[model samples]
Target: GREAEGDIQKGQKEKEEKEKGREDQEAAAGASLGEEAPCSRGALLSPSRKAWNPGPAESKLELHPLLNRWALWFFKNDHSRTWQDNLQLVTKFDTVEDFWAMYSNIQLASKLSSGCDYALFKDGIEPMWEDSRNKRGGRWLVSLAKQQRHSELDHLWLETLLCLIGESFEEHSREVCGAVINIRTKRDKIAVWTREAENQEGVLHIGRVYKERLGLSTKTVIGYQAHADTASKSSSLAKNKFVV
Candidate 1:
């Protein structure tokens, strides 16, 4: 009986020691896991769990805001659709970067099909002459030859846009409504539309500034035609209300 009891006591002690060994190994494994590098844990995490790291501040471009928010309109000639239906509002942009981004991505004025037009008007105003802000206004007409479409058209149009967004007109900038580039088979026309036709001083100043910016020769005379005269005219023979 005494011998049997000794054997049982030894077996019980061995079992307890094995259990202690297993517990110690488990505790050590947990400690090792806690001490592991962050990279190891990051690998197990989902993509969304990771923090967002923005690009370097110095490399990011700060966009320049323009004086006025402008809306760009494209008019495609369609026999089936009315004139109003053909005009589409492409987008409105208030920043210089955004404007260039849009301009660079779209077809150039010279590239648009004939009878089409590109109009840049102040936000909330339609490009039509009938718009309340434009009904009494006139445009400083720049008639471009067919040959000049490829060479000078784009440059002149870009300068016109820069003049507008840059507010190059100074005090008379308010008188300016927008500009239009009409692509035609016979001749492409560019014009700076102003808010008032009766204000002779403002009209002449805008025309002179526009012509100079366009790098037009002194001999090249551009005329201003009132919306009323244009609306009444049956053909291209609208009488010039003011000439510069």
Candidate 2:
């Protein structure tokens, strides 16, 4: 029994070390981007990395409210279920603290099974292109190689979500509809869906700001595709209306 306990403890220590290493890597990436990570407050770490125990039950903690209330939706690709049935509304939050709390409690994007997706959008907006707000719009799509899912996917996804809730696009934020992360076996994608594809100024501005916020290299191009086009064809075959 004592020997078994020793092995279990050693395994726990190794797991802790791996978690710490992941956190360090994310921090370094954020530093290179000239910004602090959205999870820097230890919000994104695995449960083993830190004990996230709350204080007194009646404790009053001040919450920083966001300009918009956002809804989080999860889609698990289950052939047994209808498309709508597979999509579930996880929760909605309007405060920064609440967002962090929700994020800390959920499984990280990178950990989601292939074909799953996580979407964050303004409270009333559904994630589908069929939504009235999204019908006439387009998306700024960033495709990631399968190799990047392990090292870069989670960080990029969180940054995208923060950009949405943080209003990182300044005045163009009004054009923002939401962001989606699609997990795939071959390659993954993240897209910021906006309300008007015809509003070139707003769309381009969002694209520029989003790319920079993701710390993507200037040479690494991202494309904006209209919902109309994407609806008619596979994403791979859809032509980009704008690139940044």
Candidate with the greatest TM-score versus the true structure:
2
- lDDT, model 1: 0.74
Off by over 4 Å in 2: 1-59
lDDT of 1 by residue, 6-43 (tens): 11122444444434454354354332222321122122
Q: What is the lDDT of residue 213 in candidate 2?
A: 84
RMSD of 1: 25.4
Per-model CA lDDT versus the true structure: 0.74, 0.78
Clashing residue pairs, candidate 2?
Answer: none
How far in Å is the alpha carbon of 156 misplaced in model 2? 0.2
lDDT of 2 by residue, 24-48 (tens): 5545433221232222322222222
Q: Which ten residues in a row have the lowest lDDT in candidate 2?
A: 1-10
Give the number of the best model, judged by lDDT. Answer: 2
